[model samples]
Target: MSDRQRSDTVHYDGPAGGWGSLRGITRIFGKEWNSPAVLETLARQNKPGGFMCTSCAWTKPANHNPLEFCENGAKATLWELTTRRCTPEFFGKHTVTEMLDWTDYDLEQQGRLTHPLRYDHATDRYVPCSWDEAFAAIGRELKALHPDEAVFYSSGRASLETAYLYALFARLYGTNNLPDSSNMCHETTSVALKKVIGAPVGTCVFDDFSHCDAIFFFGQNTGSNSPRFLHPLQEAVKRGCKIVTFNPVREKGLIAMVNPQSPTEMLTGQETQISCAYLQVKPGGDIAALMGLCKHVLEKDDEAKLEDRSVLDRTFIAEHTTGFAAFEQKVRDTSWDEIEQNSGLTRRALKDAGQVYVEAERTIGIYGMGLTQQVHGFENVAMFVNLLLMKGNIGREGTGISPVRGHSNVQGQRTVGIAEKPELVPLDKLAQMYGFEPPRNKGLNTVDACEGILAGKVKAFIGLGGNFVRAIPEKEAMEEAWRRMRLTVQIATKLNRSHLINGEVAYLLPCLGRSEEDLQASGPQTVTMEDSLSCVHGSIGKRSPASEHLLSELAIVAGMAKATLPPNPNVTWDEWVGDYGKVRDRIEETYPDQFAQFNERMFTPGGFYRGNSARDRVWKTESGKAEFTAPKHLSATGFADAPGRYRLITLRSNDQFNTTVYGYSDRLRGIEGTRNVLLINPDEIKRMGLESGQMVGLETDAEDGRTRRIYGLAVTPFDLPDGAVAGYYPELNVLVPLSHHDVQSKTPASKAVPVRILV
Candidate 1:
């Protein structure tokens, strides 16, 4: 390893979530974030049988404490429940053109949207409009267009109830162009897992963390992204589990973590070691790393067999899985030189990591966007699952495949029917339940949606709750395409770049947030969300609403449906909106098997787990057994290729969640005050003849005849493999082309881009 590269005391040296995290928390909820009501509001957050955290969709531990929310979760709650306001007066003071100049953090800091707004061409500002008037106008535009011309985008933060209604409305209005945040982040995980495990979600739940003897974290950072995961990691370390981590960047969370929730540890200033072994694989080399482990395991199994001993679970393999012979042969056939160079790890290191896996009886493989945003994202996940299946490590206590979802309820949105591919959702059942034949055509994911918009094929776009333009790749193209739409509607709690980058006619409708109470015609209401582990529970907001004019996401969807649809008797949007329980009832009717006793389960403790047949070793696949799939390649790109170009992987800073920027300082990697810098290995910087703090231009290496570049980015020498670089996303979003994505899932390959540095 290279000597320690310092950024002049910028890097945080303390364990994650110590006094530093407490100070960070105080900074946010106190004067810095300026959300005084957060602590009182957070008192109800993640409490037993209370509302869930508005942040990442990590599954909560059973018997959660009164203050179970993490520091980031507190920031999210403050962001939602802040006393700040963005009313008509705020808009009157600033033009849409002016607001476009503000940073994402500044724009959101302007605070919660308080009233409905419509784009005014005459004044170049958003003028206040009545909710009914805006809804009717949007309905008129949507009704006039062909259903195929309308694109409905969903966000992960939207509750399952709201998402279900949005899908219903889109189908009733006649379209399946249901693109969403999931399409951008975890579509690869969903696609690959479904093909191999019969279920598209994680097989293991929160309980696995307590029992697993070995856990492999491939490209996931538990500290900044999923902070709640630190508790389990700390526990696993205490129990002496082998936590092997494979990531391109050395995330602080993966190295060490101090659980802020632990009073004893906090008082003593002690920290727990997270990873027993950290393998710094190159960008997009996750498949190579997994396959290397597979190769070592196969060799060990072969040796054990010759000695009349057994290392592989031969009985579990023969009884529950198929295609092992082919999987094993492929691993053996792959050259070690190719694996070593691609993975940026030695054969001995991989063998040592595999030894830990072989020694542990119960192992869990977990991954995040680091693997999923690559060109081989789907295959990347499949490779990990393939390794776990070799030992029959799934379908038992403490062992299975888990995709650490980037957003809360991203998986649930799919479970409750926010899918681009129509087959994932029950089209026949939706039609039967709603008295309308749902659109059978496969819809657009994020990439396809952008293409459609650019081509002028999509006339209208309705986003349930997301900054689609900012979260997706190809920012310049997306911004231009966003302006091409005839009509645009954003259901949001606050303003984002998307609200300004609008169509001919754009409307921003304010809605009740997760931390606020929602009162409807029936009375107080509760919305449900499904966590990453597939536990469905209710989230009821009891805090005061941000604005009196604010409506629930359910009401807004229902109002839009009422305005657009032609009085359908079978499904009454207005009636359902009056009482959220009706929506749950409808959900139960449509998905009887999955949502069995839906309303009843909401009151049950810890909600209810939507059981995965794959976890029970019951393969719902056509073969009636778990099937192994060989990856298309061991690595997305090869070494000794693309000379003078660095493999760039865009990632989020510790200061942000998805596209929401909480602050400019990223304490995780020691990035402070700006999101404009790029972290490159010192070797690359030296080779390029660039100074450590030199400003450089980045141009994408693409097959297409177009130049995409983000210039004037400050480069900092950091801890990463040679010929690799890391930069915050949405800034380098232009470097990722619209066409560059996973073929099967159409997810943008934001994490893997080949770019050359310019001084």
Candidate 2:
């Protein structure tokens, strides 16, 4: 049956967490892993001595409760600890062509991959292959092409040791095409922050959550993305902290939440209200909304000056910041009519929200992909820094910017040198340590890599983890282009669509998951990961490997490096694989400033903080001061509105993490059974003369002349803005044009696509 036939929707007015979350956790555990290993896994999650939670990058608190895992964290743990396995026998029964017809959820539910397999073009199937044979074949394929022709991709799931080795391997091979998960999610934050605050990562650590008196959330849904963060929000609320949110949809997490760990709250069905003010701004309207807040604050600062009261931190501005005059002029020049029209918020509402910022002595600004995945994503983030700068809400305790990272170690991967730009990494240090001059030319990013593949410029692809073909925009085009590549290798724990889309020479290398023990020749090895807050902690797998044939990611990467390169006397790939500590030591030599005493500090009780210079009022910018950016216009997205077009925002359901679909339910949004649905505002539905459950189709208003469309989707009314619509990602990724992205960062504008409904 088709997805539309089985799909249905319901009205869910209940709070985000309560019994609903408990039931979801119970269902996943019973479905995937009903063994005592689940409990053991939960106990180890987010602990310094245990495995980092693979669900999200939210950090663990220093003083934590015994049961620190959230409902989604439990689900992610169970998912990795499933009993089911995808063996060679399973692959023999189904050909690659046949599996292409399966759903993403069905493909993943087949469980963890247990053996290495090589694709056979004649049989159109994957067959069992020895490690030596696969390695030799991949080496042959890679050696046939220039180093520049190969694109090395790493997922956010990879540990620091694995990622460090992966980056070194690529640089040794004389190429810098290292595109990763951040390319699509938070590259805008990295690019924008590097120019504004001279740091590419968030300034707030987990401890900052407790000392802040107020927080402003922009385009962030803490419940669905990082459920573990709700605990801090719950405590902050109890302490009477003011939380304000500006998003297109009134996210359930921002509205109210019930802590599943609390017996009194869970048993009594009590919920804590999360946000004091939730402003439902229009889709892609975050820039205008942020500007409106800044305008109100600027005007308030003027009034405060008259009364001899301190509103703006004029002292901090004069001593540590630059371009304030131009930034202030831009804010004052922006009329309220433009701000209200673009932001879909009233002057009164924005002023009230600004008043909260004005009153709070210390405040934290938090955001997610909603603000970073737009046409003006870079400007959107820079504007937020501007707002915080005006109030001097940075470089001090309890005051900074927090970007909620989606992947567990995406930030870590970037820190360890998974970047396309050569200037981002320390090439001189790498050359001195590795005895090789690294390539200096800028390499292909995610979008650039896709374009290169389609143009026959990039011939080989190696993925450390993740479903690249499925996660990126222009899915169909990427799939077709991927097939033409000379070689493709995926090092993963589970099966996904990217594996089925085989190239001329494809190898599926099964690797141990983070929760599985990596017993190397030396002994049981431990890998470390950096969380969203920049804490680098150790992760020791608690469970045994799913199969004896499975290898650690470090081993696989080292094997490829050994086979691909003709004996390099300078690098010892085998030694690093035998004991991961050797890898950490080399990492220390390369980045002594940050990774000093790397092995010793990584396993510390709460892990060591990778200090942020911005937090200490030290600016690394060229001007030696924090820079303020003023955009040329107030539009968040450059797209002009049309009669039948609506701003489309793609999001994730609670059941999915990134492109990995776990089930067919979005419990928080009241969607179940299928993902083939579109959420529209009730007013928009009425104005369009459409019914609530009307089956409809959508076509992109991209004007690219490529007919991007989806069919047989049910239109469900939701509490979204009138001119906006929302749908699940990956499925809706087709509507996202390849060329539509943030011009500065080159990150895809997944959150903002313009489409028209066809009844």
Candidate 3:
């Protein structure tokens, strides 16, 4: 049978309260108590002096109960603590070709790697290699290449210390090719926030959700993407806060949620309403919807401001902002007809949303990749900033902009200077602190790195935790480039797609997972991580190492540094590797303000938080105050001349997390045993004369005449708006060309692609 037929062998979508819910309940209870892995993982969750949850970026209260983990968090924990092991003997029996043929789920589920393995081209198999030999080979190859030819990639799962050290090593080696996971997801948010607010971080904290009178949620699926966010949403609803959601699909959690935390609600099976108003906006139409709301508010402010203090903060705007007059003029000049046609929303609906914001005393706006992964993503965010500034919602108790970052430490990695284009001031500071002139040349981001590889300008690649190939867009081009590199080094816990696509010399170096203890020469060492909320905390693993031969990410970096960099009299790379405290000392010396008390703070339960823009209201703009930005006339995703094509938005299943597939089922979406289904509106399917559950092919409508297609997909009728559809990511990333990326951020517009469906 074909893969699609095998996937469809099982299908069941009964009521969630029956055996389905019982299975889920059994999985949760059984995994926690009966399974040894679950018990060990639960011990780490929210424990005092332990690491922050590595699953999601949500931050909890400083002193929460010991079991403050979410459902996905439990999944991640169990996955890490699995008993299966992929040892060198296992690799000895399987060839790279054979391994590549296996599905991603099977490849990862084979288990954690036990030792470093080097791929042999002659045998087409990977063989075990000692740490010393692997380091020497990598160093030799890297030293042979010019600094510009080497690329370093970091994942969001990497600890702050590992990322900082990796940056230092890359700079020391004289290269800035640091393409990271951020480049693929939220690079647009960072780029836009910096231009408008002078800071790339969000301006809201967990506490801000409690105080907000209303929140405008755009393109964010809180239930699956960040389940921990549901608790706060529940609390906000209890406090009578209005939630307005705008998305292509109606997410279940956004409309009504059964709070598992509430004993009364849980026992009675009661559900609480979440979104006061849910608008089904077309895919890639976020800019138009947002602009329409801004226009509505500006046009009616004169009459509406009579009773609503939230309509406009005249005092704050006059003192702390500029460019409002220009922004207001642009909103006034914008026509409602254009907004309605582009946003696919009626003028009345837009006005109703505007009125909510106008009446609420305090309001916050939260967005996700749906808004960020677009050609005009940067401008889309700037438009939101304009709206917030117009209403003076920023730097207040209950109002601000919150960009829901995906990775656990994505924000933190950027915080400690992990940028391809490091500012001159930070470079100068590092030079002064480390006694060496830092490289001033700009570095390569994800897109730039891929270009370099394809052009043969990049020779070496180093990945610090992540499946680089699958995580990036333009998979075919990226895979081809990976094969052309002189050397590829992966510091990961398990085998991934990146490991299969090798270069002349490729090494898969197994490392300690987040749940495993890290022992250096000095003894057990602990690392620190920063959550989305800007809170820094210590993470010390209690579980034994997955393999005795596996090394910590820090050690691997140090080993590579020893082999690659020339003897530097100022920096003691050996000493830092010997004792993790020495690394902390270096961090303190480098970024004293951020890493002060790095050694002593770990002992404190729940490590200290860093400085945040929301707490102090310190606008770091050129004018020393927040500024209103004018909206540029641009569509969210640029339209192609696809006469009969619809824009398709790609998302993740509830069982998947950034290329790591836990299972093939998406329980909440009623999908079972398959990830190859296309979600379409019933009207659109009927218009096209396509039946639900029929196999269909999707082709991209690109100007280059490139035929990007995914065939044999079952169509599931959903409540999607016309001209919009949904599919899984990475699978659909093939349709998104590398050239079709956000202009300012270079982030692939994966969430917005024009395609034609055929049965």
The model with the greatest lDDT is 2
RMSD values for the candidates in order, in angstroms, are: 1.8, 3.3, 4.2
**Candidate 3: 10-residue stretch with minimal lDDT:** 1-10
Candidate 1, 1-759: lDDT as tens digits: 222325442466877887778877777776434344556667767765677887898886667766788878888887787768899998899999998889889899888899999999789899999988998998899889999999889888888899999888888888889888888988888888888878888898888888999999988877889888887888888988889988888888888777777788889988787888888898888888998999988889889989998888889999998888888878888999989988988999899999999899999998988888878888898888889998899999999998888677777888888887888888898877767788899887788888999999999999888888887777887788778789999999989998998899899999998878888889989888888888887888878888899998888988888889898789877788888999999889888888988888874556579889999999877688888877768776432357887888888888888889988768878888888888887766777787867788898887688788888788887788877888887778888888888767878888778887766
* Candidate 3: clashing pairs of residues: none
Residue 333 alpha-carbon offset, candidate 2, angstroms = 0.9
Once model 1 is optimally superposed onto the true structure by TM-score, how far is the C-alpha of residue 506 displaced, in angstroms? 1.0
Q: Lowest-lDDT window of 10 residues in candidate 2?
A: 1-10
| TM-score versus the correct structure, for each prediction | 0.97, 0.98, 0.94
lDDT by residue (tens digit), candidate 2, 1-759: 001111233446678788888888888988886568778889878886888888899887667778878778888889988889999999889999999999899998999899999999999888999999999999898889999999999989999999998998998988999999999999999999999999998899877878898999999888889988998998998998899998887678888888877899988889898888888888888888999999999888889889998688999999999999999999989999999998988988899999899999899999999889998999899999999999788898889999999888999999888898999999998887777889999999998999999899999999999999988988888888899999999998889989998789999999998998898879999999888888899999979888999988989999998888877777989888889999999888878889999988987766789889999889999889999888775766769888998899998988888888878878887888989888987778889999977899988897777888898889888777778998888889888888989989889998778899988
**lDDT score for candidate 1 against the true structure:** 0.84
TM-score: the better of candidates 1 and 3: 1
Pairs with backbone N, CA or C atoms under 3 Å apart (clashes), candidate 2: none
Point out the higher-scoring one by lDDT: 1 or 2.
2
TM-score of 1: 0.97
Off by over 4 Å in 2: 1-11
Tens digit of per-residue lDDT, candidate 3, span 209-312? 88999999998888777876887888898989998888876666676677555568667777777888888887777778888888877767776667663357
